[model samples]
Target: MRAVIATEPGGPEVLTVTEIADPEIGPGEVLLDVAAAGLNRADLLQRQGFYPPPPGASDVIGMECSGTVAAVGPDVTGWSVGDQACALLAGGGYAERVAVPAGQLMPVPDGVDLVTAAAIPEVAATVWSNVFMVAGLQPQETLLVHGGAGGIGSFAIQLAHQLGSRVVTTAGSADKLAACTALGADVAINYRDQDFVEVVAEQTDGGVDVILDNMGAKYLDRNIDALRTQGRLVIIGMQGGTKAELDINKLLRKRGAVIATNLRGRPVEEKSAICASVVQHVWPLVAEGLVQPIVGRSFPLAEAGAAHAYMESGDHSGKILLTV
Candidate 1:
């Protein structure tokens, strides 16, 4: 099998394609002839030695993939060979083939191509588990999402809009904000030109009811200032620096909650639960054409380095994909 291995991570130049032994399937696992894999910011971080795969996970950088089942492990049932499926991976997606636990896989929606299906799993699972499952965003409430044109943010905007929430989003450029508005965001602010705190407060009259933040320390204070009373703040990634300062009085006055979460490190049972929820609930929206995965661009497997460079440039919108 051909695989992209990070030979002593430092930069995109570290990714090397080499022939390696195929990953063996374990009980309850399925072997996939990967059609495509999604490139995430986390993959860049991992390649630079900032993030490592969680304990017992594959060291390869990929986090999600879509393909056909080549074979099923002995203990697997219900899913036979040749099913069109997408899966959330802890690692090992940057390869010709990957072995995925059956519990982590979902059948691709009808009419969706394999490449686009690769773009859906991570963004779907991330936004659904965080903004919906953990934060409990309600219909008619105001929701504010940061990085509105990025992978997870774009998905969050659509889901919140479809669920009847008034959505607000902050991005660095007017063009990005315009894209967010087209995706049903009620209020879109250019973060580089204005402070989102004032823009959100003016729109919602105080602040929004929910906030999805990826900027950790840099936005910590401002995020609190932009939340309405009893609002929920969900943190899924830390693009900004780590250490942060908080104003305890602000929480006391608002009676709100601040929650930090990560989906990749979760136990198998929890991931399986999220997969089931997506199959039952989110899949219907996909099948009905109410939602679709946004795949921004694609590079072949050998060009994983270029994919990383593109993502780091911050010039692309939606999800970046690597065709295997």
Candidate 2:
């Protein structure tokens, strides 16, 4: 088997593909021959020596992938050799073969290609779990998403819109903003030039009902300002830095809530439940063409380094993939 690993904690240049032993499946796990793996911002953080995989997870740097089952371990059922599925993984998705907990495997939605299925797991799970499950976004509510041109943001925009929420998002450029609008964001702010807090306030009449934020401390104060009374702010990434001051009085005045979460570090039971909810609720929208997987680009597995470099460039939209 072949896998990608960072030669050292550094830049994208440190990433390389090399021969490695295939992962052996444990009880209740299935072995997959990967078809493709999704690239995520966390992958970049890992390459730079910032984010390490959870304890006992594979050191290989990838979070989600689509693949065919090659074998099933003891205690695993409902999957068999040659079954096609996509999996949300803690790590090892960058490799040609990976061991996946059976509970984390999901069937590819109808009308989606196997490789494109690679693009769906992580983003779908993240958006659904954060926006709807955690924050309890409802129909007729307004939801704001930061980094709207990126994988998680793009999916959040479409899903919220399709589910009857008014969606507002922020992107860095006009084209990216346009893409967000096309994906059903009611308002797309150019973060480089506009004050998102103001736009969100104007768009929703007061402030948004929920905000799915990826930028951490840099947007913290403004995010609070952009929330309506009783609003929820869900922070899943620290791309904007990790430390900031919070205005407790402001939050208390509005009765708002702030939460920070990590999908990668969650327990298997929680991940499995999220995956089950996604399949039951989100998969139908995909099957009906109400929501689509937006794959911006793909590189062969051997070009994992190039894929990481491209993600860092901030030149692409939606999900980037490594095809095996």
Candidate 3:
């Protein structure tokens, strides 16, 4: 097997592809010959030595992939050799082969190709679990999304729109905002020159009902200010920095709740449940073409360093993929 390894975490230049031992499956696991893998911001963090894989996880730098089942491990059922599947991996999707728990394997949606399917699991699960399941965004509610041109934000905009919620999103430029609007955002604000909090408040007649945030502490105070009474704010990224003061008084006055979550470190049982929910709810939307993979660009597996560079440059929208 060949996988990407960070040769002393620092920059994209630190990443290199090298021969590695093949993975073996355990009970209830499946062995996959990876077709493609998705690139995410977390991958950049891992390369910089800010994030490390969970104990016993593959040190390889990918979190989701599409592949064909090569073999199923002991006690696995309902999947067979040659089945087309996409998996939410703890790590190791950057390799040619990976061992995934059967519970994390989802059949490729009817309308999607195998390579594109690699872009779905991580963003879909993150959006569905955070906005729908955890935040409890309801139809007719207004949802605010930060970084709307990126993978999770693009998916969140579409899914919220399709589910009957009014969507408001902020991006860095007019072109990015336009792209967000094309994906069904009801209101797109250019964060570089606009006040998203005010825009969301005016558009929603006070504030938004749910906010999917990636900027973390940099936007915390303003995020709380943008929320309506009883609103939910789910923070999934920390690109902005980790430490910030919270106004407990303001949160209490609005009766709002804050949640911080990460998909990578969760237990297998919890991940399995989230995967099942996505297969049930999100897969149908995708199969019907109501939602689709938003692949911004792809790189051959060997050029993963370039892929990381592109993503870090913030010059691309949606998911970047590595073709295995």
**TM-score per candidate:** 0.98, 0.99, 0.99
Q: Please, what is the whole-model Cα lDDT of each candidate in the order they appear?
A: 0.90, 0.94, 0.95
Q: Provide the global lDDT of candidate 3 against the true structure.
A: 0.95
Model 1 lDDT, residue 316, Cα = 89
- Note the clash tally of each candidate: 0, 0, 0
Writing each residue's lDDT as its tens digit, candidate 1 over 56-138 gives 88888899999999999989987988899999999999998999989999999877888889999999999888888889888
The residue-level lDDT of candidate 3 at 183 comes to 99
Off by over 4 Å in 1: none
Candidate 3: misplaced stretches above 4 Å?
none
For model 1, the local distance difference test gives 0.90
Candidates ranked by TM-score, best first?
A: 3, 2, 1
lDDT of 3 by residue, 71-113 (tens): 9999999999999999999999999999998999999999899
Error of 2 at 5 (Å): 1.0
State in Å the error of residue 36, model 2.
0.3
TM-score of 2: 0.99
